[model samples]
Target chain A: MLNVLWPIFIIISIIYAILSGNIENVNKSIFDSVDNAVKFSINLLGMTCLWSGLMEIAVNTNIIRFLNKVLKPIMKKLFPDLEPENKASKDITMNIIANILGLGNAATPLGLKAIEELQKENNHKETLSDNMIMLILLNTASLQIIPTTVLSLRNSLQSDNPTEIIFPVWVATICAALAGITITKILIKKGM
Target chain B: MKIINYVSIVSMPILIFIILMNGVKERKNVFDIFLKGAVEGIEIVFKILPTLVGLFFAIGFLRNSGILDFIINIISPIINIFHVPKEIIPLALIRPISGSASLAIATDIMQQNGVDSFVGKLASVIMGSTETTIYTIAVYSSCVKIKNIRFVLFAALIADIVGMISAIIICNIIFV
Candidate 1:
């Protein structure tokens, strides 16, 4: 996806600069960007390391497992059609837990695994089931307690209080999650 | 609510404290374990460097050459109905398709409209509040070999709109 979009951006900028006669400024910006990006990455380095190390501790302390345990029953309730002990449900639960913590990179593999497990139960072989639809809905809803990446960005840009949006982000994502789940349930009940 | 916000803000420090306490309980080398994970985290940052540089260059040139604003002008009237800043139109468009694209755009928005400004805050909220629905559907449905998405796309897009609307309204009330 980036392969296609990146080049288009490059081409558009070059052409637009030529036509608009802003060629000099565009050229300077293109070169200046690497330095800025590196600086931004360095800013990110501290937080990523902090959080990842903390995640290791959380793992070692069995905190992550405890979280998984708490969310597992909610998963079963959400997808009542699936067996209580199903592997897909386990994967889905782990994925959602990771997402709730705003660990997207962590959630992705679990989400993929869940989908792969869902594919196995797909007797239709080519069509989706209601359970799969619900999983997809929840996974893509952006329900999270922390908006980690955004906070990191704000910190990089030197916000007075980087985490100020914490409550607002939480509210926004909760609304998205609720609306997503409600829409999915309504659609499924309508036999879509 | 303010108390809850403070709690969540300090939640990580508290989490680290609990984990270290548990580390001591388990007789593990807490410092060594932390160092190991931190090293891996640093590696993740370096891994992202090349892509970040490339994206930055592209986004920079686009913004500098005035193309982004030109495109924004084209879409401004339509989006004015929702009263979102013209600067964020590109973000709203690509947000559900690509995370990096939207992040690049959000950074651009922040650069243009100072980080604390309403537009910048709105961009941040929107970026963090919604999923890349089309991209996610493409990946997950393909993984499950589901050709017919049926109402999945519809429901997801509706959620995106709802998420976007709530993000705007809430940010306006609080941040603006």
Candidate 2:
């Protein structure tokens, strides 16, 4: 899907840039943002490393297991077909925990691991299942606790109070997550 | 807000302290383990390098080409009904598809409007609350070999819309 969409984005951008007679600005930006983006992602590494390392310790010390113990029932409710003791359920809980902590890049592999496990549960079905859809909804809405990236960006840009948006972000994301899950559940009930 | 503030301030210290205490109890080389995990974390950063490059490249072209303003002008009337600023339409449009683009735009917004301004606050809230919907869908579906996305796209998009609207409301209530 991204394979197709990515090229189209590039093509349309170039064409539009030319048509708008913004060729010079566009040309300048090509060199400008590319290097900056690379540097930006690398700069993200410092924070990600700290979080991921802490999470690694949490996993090693069985804190994550305890979290899974608490979250399993809720997970079972969300994904009725997933067995509480199964690998997929555990991965899902781990993914959710990582996401709630606002571990963006770190959460992707965890989510993909979840999808992989869910695939196994589906007996290798080529099409998406209801649980898969629900999981994706949860991921997209994200319901994060600390929006670290936004805060860091704000701080870098010298916001008087970088973390001021924390409350609003949490409230807004909860609404998004609840609405997303409800919509997915409704769609599932409709057997769509 | 206070709870969030405390959590944001205290969560990291508490987490690290617990990990240290656990490491001591468990009799393991936790520092080495941490370094290893950190290395893996750096690898994850590198893993996203390609996506970042492509996204930034496209965004740079599109944004610099003035296509965004043109599109925003077209959508201004509709969004204005919801009291959304014309400047924010770009952030809302690209946020669900590309985080990097939205980050760039949000920085620009803050740079232009001052971080505490209504539009600046709204952009921050929206970016924080919403996910890269299309990218999430694409990565997950392919990972699980899910050929048909079914209702996933609609659900993600709707969630993004809800997040955007809530960002607007919360920003107005809190920051405006």
Candidate 3:
């Protein structure tokens, strides 16, 4: 997917920049984007290391097992084919937990780890499995409970009631998640 | 707001404490295990560095080139037929593409529309509900070296569209 989309973005951007006489901005954006990407990754490293370490502890201590037990009912619905003891299940559970808590920084590392674990079980090395696609959909739907960053941004902008959108956010997120799961299931059944 | 603040602040520390305590109870060499995991984390980050650079470069061009505004302008008339606020078009379009881009647009919406206004609240809901679909998919798939993500992008985009429409409808009913 990114294979085609990435080049299209650059091509369209160049054409548009040329038409609008903003080629210089596009040139600067190229260099700046690379620099920003590195800086952003560096910013992520600290939290990623911390959560990765903590998750390791959780795994070693059977805490993940406890969590898996706790989340089993819901997990079963989302991942019926997955075995209870699979390492991917543990990583997926932790990723979902981090996302729900609005710890996006933590979620990325955990999610990457989840993908790595899922890859180990994949029969086709290049093609994504149903489970993998579902996991990505779950992340994209983003069922965050608090949306702390949005609230903070609103607060900084001096909103009179910064947290008032929480209910609406929850409603939208649940709908998105359901829609994602339903569509993916339909497509998978149709052999897409 | 205060309750939200309190929860966000306390959740992290409490979670960390619980995990460490559990490790101790299990008689694990916590520091050694942590070091091992951190090393893996570093490797994962390194693996993703190229993907981020590529994705972000595309996003930067698409953002700074005024293409988003152009697209928004083209769509605004059609979207206005549905009574969706014009200000949210940029946000809804950008939300699934780039997190930072959407954040900037959302902040701009709130600044211009008043943070307590209908458009501002709707933007907030949209931001909270949707993820950076392209960025997340790229990073995760690339890390695993998965080239074919059949229907994953399609389904994720549907979710994003549903989330944005839900935000608009829910806000209309509640805010009105």
Best by lDDT: 3
In the range A85-166, model 3's lDDT, one tens digit per residue, is 7888988998898888788877888888888888988999999998999899989988788888898899899988888899
Report the C-alpha lDDT of model 1 over B35-68, residue by residue, as the tens digit. 8777766766675577567767877887789897
Q: Rank the candidates by DockQ, best first.
A: 3, 2, 1
Look at candidate 1 and give me any clashing residue pairs: none
lDDT of 1 at B99: 68
On a 0 to 100 scale, what is the lDDT of residue A159 in model 3?
A: 89
Model 3 residue A174 CA deviation (Å) reads: 0.4
Against the native complex, each candidate's DockQ, computed on alpha carbons, is 0.47, 0.60, 0.78
- Tell me the TM-score of each prediction against the true structure: 0.69, 0.85, 0.96
lDDT of 3 at B82: 95
Give lDDT tens digits, candidate 2, residues B1-176: 55766787787677678778987798878888888777767766676667677767777776788877788889989989878888888888888877767787889998999887878888889888998898678767865557678889998898889888888888888876
Model 3 TM-score (2 dp)? 0.96
| Model 3 misplaced regions, further than 4 Å | none
The residue ranges of model 2 lying beyond 4 angstroms of the native Cα positions read A33-37, A44-54, A124-126, A153-164, B1-4, B28-47, B142-147, B174-176
Sort every candidate by TM-score, greatest first: 3, 2, 1
Candidate 2, residue B30: Cα displacement in angstroms equals: 3.8
Fraction of the real A/B interface contacts present in each candidate? Answer: 0.75, 0.76, 0.86
